[model samples]
Target: MSDLDASTPRIFLARHGETEWTKNGRYTGTTDLELTHHGIKQVKGTAIQLVGPGKLIDPGRIAHIWVSPRKRALQTFSLLFNNSSSSIGDGTTIAKTKVTITEDIAEWDYGDYEGLLVGEIRAGRKKRGLDSETAWNIWRDGCEGGESAEQVTERLDRLISEIREIQEPYMNGGNAVDVVLVAHGLILRAFAKRWLNYPIDSPLPLMFSPGAIGILSYKNHDIDEPGFYLGMALPLQD
Candidate 1:
């Protein structure tokens, strides 16, 4: 937190920890799955290292939070603040932060391909002559009976507008209005893309590992110049 500009509000993108479907590389969109024991440990570790007063994500500084409606994301958000109580490393309470469970930040709807592996999806598509021309690409072709890349872009853009509206007033120095979004892998990446005004089908190679955290903020403390942080060092805390 110290390494970055305080005047620029940050959006902490937290990808939910691993589930059985995530571990098996299955398409988990729209599926309600609980975190595995190991996944619980992953988020707990993230909480200790990145959350708390003077840490990368100070609960006290967060003004708003958007969580995916999925259970895994809900579990991750709870674990992030230690069950949403004053039980984090420094016992800083985030109860004041506005938390919204939103479908906008949820994973891409896999629709007919839900619960299927990548190879399985490809094979299915090939068998049906769906990808006979250019192969199956979620970014390009989207999921069958689910959402298209354009549809995803629309929702994500709307969410980004809401976030920017909240962050605009605070960008020039005021009460900390940082935001937090707890959700899944693919959606978070797409959110990042939209945050930077990139199209959802851009070639940017963005990957969000489970339980990982990424930061988005404005450049030069200007809300109009949104950008993502490549890396940030945690502040030293007593």
Candidate 2:
């Protein structure tokens, strides 16, 4: 981890809400699934707790928003910022932060394994004379015909570096150098680990629930000691 000033920069990692694959533990990459009705309601609660004035995440403080190009993630972003249903809240009250759709944040490209659960993929590999027991950790053994851990790390490193650049000018300018990222589970986890300079294959035991929110920031606002802060309001109250 790097050391940072009192307010170096903040990157908020938000996993999209539940989709059919989300609830099924499938490896969802290019296959997009709309949020479940329950998932919509889930994120609405997150918005109320985190987006409004005097809340954990002041909408005005956000400098840039990056979301995956996937429809699921876009849906998640919309529900959080511009919810149209009465159950979610009014979009008019939310700040209209410009959102960028980026492929860097998309889920791991599972390739031939897309939409297959871990067990199913492993079983298939074993039946094909391949080691599936422990040789199939996505971080180490990337999906066939898809991205490798090295590829994912390289992409995330580039994205993280650019994000740093985006926030550089805003440092100490009284402008919040806060960037929000809405993406899928695997890639988002990899991004968070990469932010801390952790090896992509490090068995870090990190887990992300559907619609989970994770925050990364420099230690004391300095760009050096990057660390994860358990500050995001995934949910506040009813």
Candidate 3:
């Protein structure tokens, strides 16, 4: 019999490396782009920081790792774990882990303005009589070529439920391990919002830079059970 615990799981979320589009301040929604050299190095640094002191992450306990279906994200995941590859060194304890490619975890789909910048989108929205604020915050207003805020919430909610299932053993203490998620900016922010049980309408001003990580601790709420709180954003700078 397999006993899965969903009571207390700490989800470690990371935003994938920076892409050319992201460097240009363009909306990278669904548009796949490769990460810059600097971006690649940035994510590698995050891996180093995790194993450092003051942080309680046990590399061996990371049982599962997840990344978006995009090439950039996949590449970042590979590089981050490349040191663990048995082919790389004579003898190194490369933590055995499984990387899962998740599709629903993709960034917000920016329908028509897929490659356009936020400024450009705002200008267009204004010409079309849409409120500038609304246009700027398409996530809140559900703009012309993008997903509505509610839709984003629904998608993230479903993803979170699945993530909990994936890390069920860890959550229930069946597996003394951690789960790593390599996703995008908005997706990570959405996870934060859901983790804190924040209002659905709250604007997500928290920007996750390339290689930034956010942690969330989940606990079943009960009369005698105390909830847990995870730490805030810890940026992995160059």
Which candidate has the top score in lDDT?
1
CA shift at 192, candidate 1, in angstroms? 0.6
| Candidates' RMSD to native | 1.8, 4.4, 6.0
Give candidate 3's error at residue 190 in angstroms.
Answer: 1.4
Give the residue spans of candidate 3 off by over 4 A.
1-8, 51-57, 84-97, 132-135, 166-174, 219-238
* Local distance difference test scores for all models: 0.87, 0.77, 0.66
For every model shown, what is its TM-score relative to the native structure? 0.94, 0.86, 0.77
Q: Comparing 1 and 3 by TM-score, which wins?
A: 1
lDDT of 2 at 79: 75
**Cα lDDT, model 2, residue 185:** 86
- Pick the winner on TM-score between candidates 2 and 3: 2
- State the local distance difference test value for candidate 3: 0.66
Model 2 spans with C-alpha error above 4 angstroms: 1-8, 84-97, 132-134, 169-173, 231-238
Candidate 3 per-residue C-alpha lDDT over 9-56 given as tens digits, one digit per residue, 9 for 90 to 100: 566777888888888888777778888999888877776665322233
Clashes of 1: 0
If ranked by TM-score, best first, what sequence of candidates would result?
1, 2, 3
Considering every candidate listed, which one attains the maximal TM-score? 1
- Candidate 1: 10-residue stretch with minimal lDDT: 82-91
